[model samples]
Target: MSETELPPEPALDAGELDADDRLKPEFVRSVLDAVEEGDTEAAKARVEPLHPADIADLIELTPADLRPALAAALSDRLDGDVLAEMNDWVREELLAALEPHQVADLAAELDTDDAVAIIETLEEEDQRAVLRALDPDDRAAIEEALSYPEESAGRLMQRELIAVPEHWTVGDVIDYLRSDEELSTDFWEIFVVDPAHRPVGTCHLSWLLRTPRVVQVTDVMRREQTLIPVDMDQEEVALRFQKYALISAAVIDAGGRLVGMITVDDVVHIISEEAGEDALLLSGAGDGDINEPVRDSYRSRVRWLVANLFTALVASFIIAQFGAAIEQMVALAVLMPIVASIGGNAGTQTMAIAVRALATNQLTQSNTLRTVRREIVVALLNGATIAVLLGIGAALVFANPQLGVVIAAAMVINVLVAGLAGVLVPVTLERLGQDPAVASSVFVTMVTDSMGFFAFLGLAVASGLVG
Candidate 1:
């Protein structure tokens, strides 16, 4: 059907596309049914009016085994924007089904960063075939982007940005933007560059529109601008964008020449991706995507489970050392888990805050000691509050005030230990050039568990509560 002949999309409610929104089950089922019935035209019509992101979601929501069939049903309706919006694994699966030249065609229609994302997923031989099929300029851009480290600014910034000589007038800039059909259509700002192609300033589109025609671009441009280094990590790039409230920024090479530009749209993706990634890493849940293959998920998770098992053994061994004390006073066994549970919870809380702070560059060498001291104070306050409640309850229930005092003291000790372990584990991992999020929880839990058992049981024995 022709574009004009197609039905208009239904108006969506305000929350229709909220961040947490998912495609309706009915809608997903309807589309899948059409695909299953071999009604390609019906499937295409059902999806045609959806946003690219929603289209991507529909694809993801479909069963993975059925996805290739869905893609085939959609056929020509699947485009680069939808592919770009797709989950990485879903996109990889779809891309694998396409021939190299067909993949090249899709890449040709995307910006350099996205095109690189698609191409880099292909095997080396397939990547070569796709590259050979692309236009020379597109091929060169993708090749250069691929050469950069993954998740770096070079691989994230788009090559198609508006950069003009610093001497151009507002009228000239406007005219050039209007006439350059090949230029990127979605830029918010124009970069002012020197003769040697170094970006010197940036002019927002709004500023250009408000200025007189004859005014020089430099006169209207802001000379001070944040420039991203090509090799900068994508997380750092997101941080810079956030810190400066930047809408767009020029990317520079080793020689400080403008190579490309990164827009806030791209940074939005990076920020979300990084935040989710850190959270997943903290749990040792690799990728944590529901659509991840079972074998892949099991492989990633079992290794961490094994490590946790060993850590649990360390806590078990501590309990063994106090087996005699536990036998004499069964109450010690009953109250032991309460101490460890609270301490473990406290440690997890502190670890989460530390990981988030480290991820956002909030916790640094300069403020590390201050953050640590603050957590220690907070831990003491929490420990005191819980200790009083538990102490009174234990004294009343067990009819032994001395037992209450010993347990209270152990509570304070374990909680303080938990606070220290939480901060120290992540900070130490970071110093060793490892991800602070990945294994910090395991180590912190180990410390809290082992120390909680040791402190509680040792004090019980020392206080003569046990034979």
Candidate 2:
């Protein structure tokens, strides 16, 4: 369907497209127009109707210098969610630009995870100031959450939860929930806990409402709860949520006391973060936030590019050794790249699979040898197919049977080596306490390139096909 024919965009207002609903392109044009006309009131009017998240996105989309002006235009509407949704580095700069009272006000409205996320973005002194400005209770809760290791479940979980002792009846649960002045604003399940406050079980809201009020909590609650430990990594939490098909899970502290809770909504964010983080890290790009400052982006990306250059020099050094060989036969120069390209592509395919398997803990020592063998087999079959096609092409192109056979043999050997290096290098790196994903790609590429050149050139030299 055409863009206009598509269902009305949600970002737009009901029955009409408002300035707040304008996406980046439209928003940018409108803001630029306002700036050109020196229309501050017009800009404010255009920005005022956006949701906090939308406003945050709009601010982020604005050029860096214009952020302060945008912030001024939006003023008090820049709430907690907007701050939370802002990229960390951008949030850091923006929080610095905001007053302490403004930062604290936004923090107070956010859930514990989002509040901590924004607070942690501040400079150390600013973090202290923002914390100090918060109410004592909010400050204490946020501080306690910050005490957990960063990116752990404790830090990510919400402090708010619905929990009751196992001895309580369904009626008691209903009454406590109804009468208690303090309860989480959002909860999908009620945790049944021990006297020690350790989660023993959980009951979905549906189960609680449908079961007779007279039923014991134990009778109604499901015993098989996936209680997440506070120290668990957020990625693991997401995995558990996915594996158990859970809507929410209770979180426990070091002593196994119920401390907080995590929901699918939080898990969704964690999953996205972890997945994107791995992708960026694999490319040696730090954070990869679009809103990241240009300098920060350059710093994060250049080191890897430099490292790649050094490695490319190493590959070039290898190629230089065959200068005489290439000079003797122009066909060798033409065909060498073919061999390297094929091997590099093959290695990358396997490296990606291995890295993903390692991340998921599916490629452990128990199955490593088996997986390696299977990959080698697959590589051999693939190599045979490609080599045959290339062999015929080489024979037709160069009109040399020996050259065709030589390239064909080199292709097969290099591809097999490529496949083995793909699995072995990554698995070994992971075992040696290195991140398999980040370093594996570079090493795999190096191996395939070097091996491809060496095998093809070495074979030709051995056969005395070139001198």
Candidate 3:
């Protein structure tokens, strides 16, 4: 930001962070230098001006060994907001370094959802310790959130929200809001509730400020609003927020009573996380966070690699069935790999698109066939282009017209099968209640590789090229 555009008293220095919001290297170096020099106050002064997110980033950027010293030097700045903004792995490590009471104090300062995130990952004993340290009200809220399944809307929503009865006028709301010292200050809207505390409407703060004091709360509130079930998946919650263009929505219990609220900021995090997760799952990299521990990264990736090995064996077994043809015609061995390679690439291209479409809810029951048909047409065009090029080149190099025609036919057949497998594998897995991104690559790769070799060799023999 330019000097003039900056706030009169900015918490964040405009020049300290790069375009990507990362702390500048020089700033990091200066802070670390002060910390190492035992000038704790200087280090704090340098970091104290940064935003909570930037403090989190600074801690993350610090070396593992030095993080303790840095955290100590700036312990006062490492508040709940900074912890909430930190990476999961990093925050877990930092929280581990603190006492249960200290962690409880930090958790108590946060909204119910963020507090739950920090506490839910603790060991059972540690969780109890933290819970015991928390105030009863805070403990109860966190305990209730913990009862929900991991990654459910209940775990994502915060208990802190603004809810006023519909019978109240704007004057009453203004008075109540002003009279109540403990109400959350972060709410964007005042949710209008029924006698039973179920959300009936939502009134943005702007509506309250603009309306006359005599206006009934129901008169200005928007009646149509999305209500999220507490048990809904976080991913589905994100989709709902996106579909409705919501800034915030009330989360309801099974009885349709208002329980908590999910804000757009929470959905943004879920969107980024799920998008990255789906991409990693497609590649079988499993929780592909660089901050992940080495053993965890190894364990997650190795299982998939093992599955891939078995899938490779299936393709190898297919290749063995055509050994006689390969022995008779050395040309078959020379060109078989090319066919498989092309088919595998083709399948991956379609699979990525299909998985993303499925994730974003763009590809649904109504459009499945249409999507398949479109991919088939694309596959045909792609296959024909590659086949013609390979065929012409093979005819010239091998000096065999029959061989070129055989491989060309095989190329077209394999690519077509590849496209079908790419879409069908994920879709079928989704239908069977499996994660398409998780298992689709293995099945799709196996289908493409096996079908490629089988088609090329089978077509060559059928064309009498081997004879």
Candidate 4:
């Protein structure tokens, strides 16, 4: 190479990652540059030192056109761990490019849950092919996992837990653990099961160490344990973990037999995903991931926009009815938007609180009335404060006390109606077996906008400010 054609930049060292442990922009660009230049060795070497998640990040950061090449360059290092860390959309793309046997190999290296996560997203025919390629044992495990509904405990649990018979002595448990090289090493607690394979108690490692070797495991194990049903929604699983401060819990089937286990680490990922999912769903944005496909993003978002369009027409229809009143006093038109906009914001704030409360199980049938009452009182206080301030300003600016009273009264009515709708819409949807977050915003926005326009204009005519 000529002197003017400078040597390629070297790989980033350990210090190059930012404080959040995210790979730096320059580092990512350098690796991508190496791949683009066809210097596969340089690209591989640059990524070799990074963690699996970081490697996943590097692939995600690579442009879509370059992803396959980058992935190919790092194929030796790309295994179950990196795949597990990848964004779901990106992983699906990479997995699609791989042969069924290749996917089986990756799935074999993962625990049951991670393996299921990787495999479940495959097409039905591809899923069957991958299953055929898997070992008999792995195939059975994955098949059972796939049988459960998506996002249930069965789909999220790993079958690699250590479960000891209830009759085993501490010494017996120790001997089996020592001798059984096939047993999983990642567990923090061991489940003690009865003859029927039903979990009776849980034994922490510390307890086993402190107890006498001759003592029965059941004697030392904690009898009070939270058992998660196989069909339990993952959100409820997260709530269980949070409420009980659980390190690990047994996942049981309909027969009350321990089928697998879920640890805190798995629940942590679920918690983040659920929280973000609910937030996005509330905004009518489906699966708001940056790596989401353009078509998918468009499809999910446009439907909501269409829904909003219909909702907006309802408000428009209200405004059209009062066109004469608005035209009679131009100030009415100028001030009307303030009522709607402020009411909308107020509704959003209350709806957020209600949704969060419901998500966390803090708002339930036992206390729904209390929550409603509390929000109503809060809305009144907010409405009154804003109304007083707005009233004075409208009075001074418009030089009409009656106009000020009209707008101020309309603001209170709209905001109060907004707050009421915010809570009621979500609760009502939830009761009707719909996801509150997914439909709440549209309904709440409709209520606020319609009431804002209707209240302001209707009150104006009654107050003799116009029309």
lDDT of 4 by residue, 150-244 (tens): 99999999999999898899999999999999999898999999999999999999999899999999889999999999999999999999999
Candidate 2 residue-wise lDDT, 2-72, digit = tens: 32122222132212455444655655557545644566676667666666767777777776777776676
Strongest candidate by TM-score = 4
Name the TM-score of candidate 1: 0.95
Lowest lDDT block of 10, candidate 3 = 2-11
TM-score of each: 0.95, 0.92, 0.94, 0.96
Ranked by TM-score from best down, the candidates are: 4, 1, 3, 2
lDDT of 1 at 153: 98
Query: Residue 447 deviation, candidate 1, in Å?
Result: 0.4
lDDT of 2 at 194: 91
Per-residue lDDT of 138-178 in model 3, one digit per residue for the tens? 99999999999999999999999999999999999999999
At residue 36, what lDDT does model 2 achieve?
42
Residue-wise lDDT of candidate 1 within 7-30, one digit each (tens)?
A: 334433323444444377656766
Clashing pairs in 4: none
Q: Per-prediction RMSD in angstroms?
A: 4.9, 4.6, 5.4, 2.8
Clashing pairs in 2: none
Better of 2 and 3 by TM-score: 3
Clash count, one per candidate: 0, 0, 0, 0
Ranking by lDDT: 4, 3, 1, 2
